[model samples]
Target: MADQDTDPRLRWLKPLVIGLSVVFVALIMALIVGLITGVPQRRAEAAKQTAKPVPANLSPAFAEQVLNLPRNSRVADVFASGERIIVRVRLADGTERLFALHSQTLQPIGQLTIQVEK
Candidate 1:
């Protein structure tokens, strides 16, 4: 009689091996997806935290002043020096004005028009 152990039909072994292999592959895929998804989320949260507030040293009074202007009235631009700050303010009249301020006091240093854009 032929030996039963040597016969090819070990029916349970094949299905169990296949099931284990599929589970292993699925686990590996899930791990890869979690790692890729986590990185940008962490970076974006860190960026949002850093972007929340400007440092008080840059211009405390100027920052406060600009907050009260009409939402449309904005800093057209800014130029800075060791002792002074040059800011361009766009008025609601659709006109632009330039003001140079003492950086330390946020006080006016000089005022001049650079250009007017209609």
Candidate 2:
């Protein structure tokens, strides 16, 4: 009587164990493949994020260009955009000015004066 009851339980236990083993093996394989293939891609993306981008229209002549500023004026900051370079200057009178230049030819494109209204 005991043997008959135990046999039914054992029959389902074998198949359940086999199914769980197969699932575990599949999970381990997937983890291994992901580690091997995904790590390089993640590293490459990180490198790209850290690297500085060079503008497409940048020219060698930009190094030789001279930008004249006003008397008693000092450069505050400089920034390079897609096709333009922006220069921020602080004047002797405490006024701020922005100069935009073409990136390729280093030609003056525009100027903006920042004044506060009293």
Expressed as tens digits, the lDDT of each residue in 53-109 for candidate 2 is: 656665558678888999999999999998789999999988999999987788899
Residues 32-64 of candidate 1 have per-residue lDDT tens digits of 998899989999999998774545865556555
Q: Model 2, residue 108: displacement in angstroms?
A: 2.7
How many clashing residue pairs appear in each of the predictions shown? 0, 0
Candidate 1 worst ten-residue window by lDDT = 62-71
How does each model score on TM-score?
A: 0.34, 0.52
> Candidate 1: misplaced stretches above 4 Å?
1-72, 113-118
TM-score of 1: 0.34
Q: Distance from true position, residue 115, model 1, in Å?
A: 6.6
What TM-score does model 2 achieve against the real structure? 0.52
Off by over 4 Å in 2: 1-58
